[model samples]
Target chain A: MLGLSITQWLFGTLSLMAIMFALMMVFTRSPVNSALYLIMTFFCIAGHYLLLNAQFLAVVQIVVYAGAIMVLFLYIIMLMNLNADEEPRKHVLTRAIAAIIGGMLLFVMIGALRGAEQLQIVQGGASQIGLVKNLGKVLFTEFLFPFEIASVLLLAALVGAIMIGKRDTNINTK
Target chain B: MLNGIPINYYIMLSAVLFIIGAVGVMARRNAIIIFMCIELMLNAVNLMLVAFSTLHNDANGQVFVFFIMAVAAAEVAVGLAILSMVYRNFKSIDIDLLSRLKN
Candidate 1:
């Protein structure tokens, strides 16, 4: 058993699955397949959120990321009819450089966090802070301004998307 | 304490995920795929934020994650719209072919 509890086991499994799916998402040639793999990765992340007891965020992660965003991705892919064979591969040298860059970044990050385990995290015992009631209270009070701004941002994005996606009738007339 | 798991574990996991996303962004030529990679990077950041939030027992970090999700949604909407328009004009979504602006 290696002295590991069930929670540790779950964490290990979820992390591995998440990494594997993310790799598959990047490596897959088909856009649809890539999207699907990314969805699986999102689910794994949601599981991580639940493990952390961020229940509201866990549900939101699934609803927003896995549900809305990925659906939009699939819709765009289907609309464009992008096929696996049609996508032109990047040069081999470019891919190798990218991999090397990523590896270096990972190495630097790990190096920076060499003593992170010794850093003490103050544990507020059995905190109910992850619940929606607590989060909403904080959100509406201290963060009220940002919350209102986010709404305006969403509105602007909606209008901009419509403007961009609509066919320009004036071009044909000219 | 998240079942006695160290915060470093979450940190490492997110770091790896973020690196994967960064590599995907740099290596892929497809604009849509690049956009997805950006989303992946954002998710990695979100995970880190939530983990820290839990560590400190503060709802503020989770609130930031919520705001991030909002911004990400808006960004995706506008980005995909632009990408679709680009496809309409160029008949392709390959970033290499869209190099007319470089000249």
Candidate 2:
């Protein structure tokens, strides 16, 4: 039962942290504060990855989501200098409806899950396939084409962002 | 004790996180905040993927998580650039003010 308690503790704490921060991200008035909370949520998720024995993914999650993507979010927020002052207040009815819809979706998903066969959670001690060596082999060998394609997709996104963001002086003359 | 936690717990956690994200997306008017909510949804999906990967004892799901991360990064780059452009033109990032298409 020691193993069960430890698993429950870790999963419980991580999920609680993740859920709270995600809620804070959504409910917070300031976009900057929302971004900060989202970053914390990412860290909590990365901790879950670590618990699952996916060390490489945990590290990548931090670097890409927390480090790179969040930096971009913050940079945009800073650039725009957004604040709650400009926000149009949402109606109480609209918020209530949204809450009802979201709650319903959660209920449906959980209900569907109730019939599923209980999965025996893998213990923490065993080395699983999430190791870098195993994942790298699979990524480069079986998933090689998709891997290259992802780079291309990233390049396209980079170019598209640059084009869209560039100032067009000709619009006034046109 | 550590290994004995049922997988349903993780799934429930994912569902809760996803619901929060979905609610945020529907309720928030600020475009940037909505975008952050979308990220939360993506992270919830990632958590589910990793949990399943552990269940199946396969690395494929982990690899998929890597792709998802790359795609998310690209998406943020382009999406944020678009948001900045919208702010430049409208002087506001509120979704309601972006109703020029509502002819």
Candidate 3:
């Protein structure tokens, strides 16, 4: 050990904050509050990306998740016109069944994890460097086709979404 | 890497986060919150990808993470638009209320 207590302290505090917000997001009753908590979770994940030396990903994580996607979420929430009075309350039987199903899922996950092959995680510091440029190179060179395909898919999805969202004036005219 | 923290620690942290997100999805009835949980899950996967990249000592994981970010962005745009449409018609974003398309 190099006696860098500050590093571990920082990482541990950040991880704790991330976990807290994640749990809050799950339990928060209001969708808007849940969305806000999820943003906090995204910010902490960006911090993790930075810790892992992926500075570019850290920036993209903020720009994409925290900034863009979260804003979109807030916009939808605003458009939905939700209030405390009208939200449907789940029946007691349904809630009980849900809890049972969730417990079973947890049990399965624990069993699967217990038997899973352990990845031999190498220990110690990495000498790796040059994150952005290297990632860009691989993205453009090796993953070029997949990237282009994703773009095409996005375009198609955009057209489909717009068509679905468009209002039909002919019905009103009739 | 500090104090010999193994790659599994990072992966495990993300895996736990992913499970938390999944539970959120199951418990939440709101569409936007469910979508947020999905994004959380995606971010967790991205965390594991970067960790694995460092483990195998390759930059490909970072590249994949970037592509995922792009796809996620696209998905959010399209998803929010649909949500807004559903809201315009139903005046609500509850998953239970979105039964117009169920048939």
lDDT of 2 by residue, A1-174 (tens): 454466678888888899999989988888788899999999999999988889999999999999999998998998988776666557889999999999899889988998999877666857468888899999999999999999999999999999989987899569
Clashing pairs in 3: none
Off by over 4 Å in 3: A1-7, A96-100, A103-130, B100-103
**Candidate 3 lDDT by residue in tens digits, A1-174:** 457455456567678888799989877777778788999999999987777677888898898789988987887676676654565555667656655665676566566666555554333336253277777788788889998998898898789778767886787699
Native-to-model Cα distance after best TM-score fit, residue A127 in candidate 3, in Å: 4.7
Report the poorest 10 consecutive residues by lDDT, candidate 1 chain A.
A116-125
State the TM-score, rounded to 2 decimals, of chain A in model 1: 0.95
The 10-residue segment with the lowest total lDDT in model 3 chain B: B1-10
TM-score of the second chain, cand. 2: 0.96
- Among the numbered candidates, top TM-score falls to 1
For every candidate, the chain B TM-score is: 0.96, 0.96, 0.93
TM-score of each: 0.96, 0.96, 0.85
How much is A161 displaced in model 3, in angstroms? 3.3
Calculate the i-RMS of every candidate, to one decimal place. Answer: 2.1, 1.3, 3.0
Error of 3 at A136 (Å): 1.2
Q: After superposition, how far is residue A143 of candidate 1 from its true place, in Å?
A: 1.1
User: Candidate 3, TM-score vs. the true structure?
Assistant: 0.85
lDDT, residue A28, candidate 2: 83
How many collisions per candidate? 0, 4, 0
True contacts kept of each: 0.67, 0.86, 0.44
Residue-level lDDT tens digits of model 3 in B12-78: 5777778777776776677877888898889889988987876677887788888888888878878
**Local lDDT at B66 for model 3:** 83
